[model samples]
Target: MVDLRRARTTPTDRPSDASGKGTRDYRHSWIVRGHWRNQYYRSRGDHRPIWIADHLAGPGDKPLIGGERVNVLRR
Candidate 1:
């Protein structure tokens, strides 16, 4: 889950402005991995092809299903 609460500038995370008006939002939900070569993917037991990336996927992360493989189809 992304931390949407107020942030404090310290030695670690830096603020975007001098007054610290904006902080880095480290929270991530999901994103498509790799190129959008295909439109849908599905693993075993899935009723339908997953049109979107995995919910657990994040930035710089690859979309994976059951820690195995993903079947993609060209749109």
Candidate 2:
């Protein structure tokens, strides 16, 4: 289970460059054992509290999303 959250130290800058991954790279990421959710909050250099996912790894009967795919990322 990959969980993505907004980075506390970096702010999204939409007007600076053409590449869109600036926000993605700085954003916090976590992989644990259910569902993926997106959210944001105000921060001032502090550790964000993370919760353990109960159903992180998808059910064995189906192929998991984002399990394996080449990510053509740009800097």
Candidate 3:
């Protein structure tokens, strides 16, 4: 069995310059969804399933396009 969920969602930013300052360019950015994976471990002759969370992949600086959705986690 595999279970996946969104861990967190955040806006992406441009790469920082030498001065450690980055521009807020959302035009070229896109949203990347998160997911989970399973890990098997052998302990005492038992296979344990470990759920690994994944981080959002992509430059989320750009605003969401039409019909695009993102799962935001509230603190």
Better of 1 and 3 by lDDT: 3
Off by over 4 Å in 2: 1-42, 58-75
Best by lDDT: 3
Off by over 4 Å in 3: 1-36, 44-46, 58-67, 70-75
**What's each prediction's TM-score?**
0.16, 0.19, 0.22
In model 2, pairs of residues that clash are: 33-56, 34-55, 34-56
lDDT of 2 by residue, 22-64 (tens): 4332223333544444434467455555554655343455544
Which candidate order results from sorting by TM-score in descending order? 3, 2, 1
Instruction: Give per-residue CA lDDT, model 1, range 23-65, as digits (tens).
Output: 6554544543543233333565435433444335544444433
lDDT of 3 by residue, 1-75 (tens): 445998896747557778887764445434344544455555665555555553443466545444556567665
Q: Which residue pairs in candidate 1 collide? A: 2-27
For candidate 2, the TM-score is 0.19
lDDT of 2 at 56: 38
lDDT of each: 0.49, 0.48, 0.54
lDDT for model 1: 0.49
